[model samples]
Target: MKSRFVTGTLVFMLVFGMTLAASAEVTLRHWDWHQPRMNIKLKYMAEYEALNPNVTFDTQVIGWDDYWTRLMSGVAGGDVPDIAQFHNSQTQAFLNHLEAFPADVFDYDRYKEEIINFEAAYLFDGTFHFYPVGIMSGLIFYNADYWEAAGLTEADIPKTWDDFVEIAKLLTKYDSAGDIQVAGFVPNGILGVFWLDLHYQLGGTLYGEGAKTVAWNNPAGIQALELIESMIFEDRVSEVGFLGFNEAMGTGHAGMAYSWSWLGGELDNNYPDLNWGVFRLPTFDGKLAPGPVARNNHETGMSVMRSVRQENKDAAFEFLRWLYEDTDYLIEVNLVLGTAPSNRTLLDDPRIAASPLISAIAEQVPYTNIPGEIPHEVENDYGLGMLQDLLFFGYPAADALATAEAEANSVLMERAVKWYVEDLYTPVTD
Candidate 1:
């Protein structure tokens, strides 16, 4: 058996086309946060190992909250995985330590032409360190049992918000004591994001002239807030102080939920017994969906490490090239992770049209706006987070919206991200 050796870094000598001794084996370590996705990766990695005959893997899954912190520590200690799974939003935290895709090896122009919103996956500085595999955006997720008990079917999927409100009333369940048991439509924790979804549908802007700060206090935005108010307060189909967005949906206490695509995987992982269905967030015009319907962010990335030895770096990228370029793997990632594949080629594949969750996401791909990562404070505290203040405390929607606008602008102006974004699709096809 070949023995391990080190010079400046641990040398695996696993370069492409290099002959390996029969007994010599190398392990490539990879780290990610999501268990559902990692399951898919592990399956493929097993196949990769079989084909190579001398490669094995050390796969690690960390919780989302502590992943970055742990990764940062690993980098500083000079003990890091050869490949790190990351979200595009977390790039600035680790970009300097990531190896850029070699210029001559991969066709950059083909990536641009073949991938949807390719630019959003990379930095504005023009060097590509991370490549996003797919995108996650807002969708309407409903409990199928509740839907059927309410005498509803897929034919009842709404063309507009007005139709959706009527359906929400049907899905809501009231107990014998006359208290809400199952809310028809619970925005609870997700109120902020779906609110932005509606605001964009109504032609509102998140920032002002030069994109320096927030400008969400306009007529369209206030109208969107008022609509939310009517649904929660006037229609009586939803309630405040209910379980949070994920809890309600996963536990079957919410008849319908407005959340991102990842909720599908979460529900699958945590609540496998749930009977759920998905539809695109309804349009405002009662016609085809139009531009700027929802805000989306990049998801699922693999970064080759700058710290790995030269031979290991070459091996890692070679494996990654196979992973990213493989259409079957691309399709499977979206299926398991509930994301829309970034590969434009997948759009025409029959598999893309088969999965309801992925199809909903793919249909809206043309209409999404990626305005970088929204300031967390604005999304959770100052802006969309103000829904409770309005509904529970009776704060006036217009005035509260104005205050939120001011606070969001303050936060946006101070944020490090430049706020420019890419638009990939709007519901133009079937």
Candidate 2:
């Protein structure tokens, strides 16, 4: 067998003749936090280079902690990679850096039907800025072994919020002297997932859907925040401060941890022997809960930068297209990154069928929705800051949420005015 590098080089040399233009030569700079999966990245990069020899890739891997800072600097400096990986939380920061998905760029309409359940993730106000990379759904993950040790069965899983609390109390373990041993449930300490989901379940609206006003201080909002406070103060489940989901899962300190599909990969890496399964978070008051859960999960997504040269744009877009349309490529990403694929067609892949964690997310697709894209500065910088203060810090939930709503409204109004002045906000289509 040929060495890996030689094999890769040969593969690309063969494909370069088919897809690459004679005069085209492009280089792409990509940044992502998958240092552990460099091999997988190299494999895909090699294949992509072969298909488009005229397009070359130069990658830079950054840890998730520093990646955002570096990415923000790149955006501010107007220097961005043609194709870069992005998280949902970071999507808002780069919206302005993305150009419309031009017809010359790709055939959106032809692939539209193939990309069901993706409109909210990539399309915004009639402008399509991203080829959505993956979709994430928040679910409660339970350790099967822990539940069994507690004499609980699959049928014992909670169906509603009240039921969940009771089950959590039951599964909670105490040492001989009555000291807490293991927690029954640990909600991921994310304001958006943990607190926001609670707020939605409690029937609170963060902002008026039309963006006309703030409305997070309603009864439901207070109720939701109070419930979270009680989970920490009253129930005394997990530790008081922010305990990361990864650490909670790795140590098996909690029977249940709320997280997205990413947890599947983490568990495999950190606790390979643990038997875990996922279930939907319980609803509030048992009215088949709505709001946050139903609102859509892809408000944050990756986008192709508009600043890249035309040739790199085409190559990067090609890679993105393959990622969405190819089954093997999609599965590889799911396996390596643990993020669910945005492409609807990949849902039924055999690989997903074999993995319960991935299948759980796939099964929820019909029920999933995207929050849709909004102005980045408003949602990312201003909104998340208020969220950190309200949820993470000890701020009164009502006042914190109310302030966040006001700040969000202010940002929206400012963007609207600018769009009007620059004539960039015109409705090109109905």
Which numbered prediction scores highest in lDDT against the true structure? 1
- Give the poorly placed runs of model 2, Cα more than 4 Å off: 1-24, 36-39, 68-79, 212-214, 233-236, 239-245, 285-296, 299-303, 372-430
Candidate 2 residue-wise lDDT, 1-430, digit = tens: 4699899998898789655557467787777677755556667778878886776778888887988788778777977767666665555566677766666656767656766454444555666776655566777888788888878887887767778877777777768986556777776455444655666556544445554443566777778767766665577665455356666766877877777767777888878887788876666654432323433354233457878777667667767666555567667766666656666777778886777766766655554444334456554666634665565567777777777777877887775412111111111111
Worst-scoring 10-residue span by lDDT in model 1: 1-10
Q: Write the per-residue lDDT of candidate 1 for residues 1-430, one digit (tens) a residue.
A: 2343353223435532244454357678999998878988999899999887677889999998888888899899988899889776666567789999886767788888887777665644766877668887999999999898888888999879999999999888889997789888988887767888888888876666555766677898789888988988888788768888789999988889899998998999889999999998887886544567888777757988899887677778878887887888878888888888887788777887998899998887777777665667877787668755654567676777788777777777677555355332334443
TM-score, every prediction: 0.88, 0.75
Backbone clashes in model 1, listed as residue pairs? 365-425, 366-425, 366-426, 367-425, 367-426
lDDT agreement with native, every candidate: 0.79, 0.64
**Model 1 lDDT at residue 273:** 97
Residue 205's C-alpha lDDT in candidate 2? 43
Residue 53, model 2: Cα distance from true site in angstroms: 3.8
For residue 386, give model 1's deviation from the true position in Å: 3.6
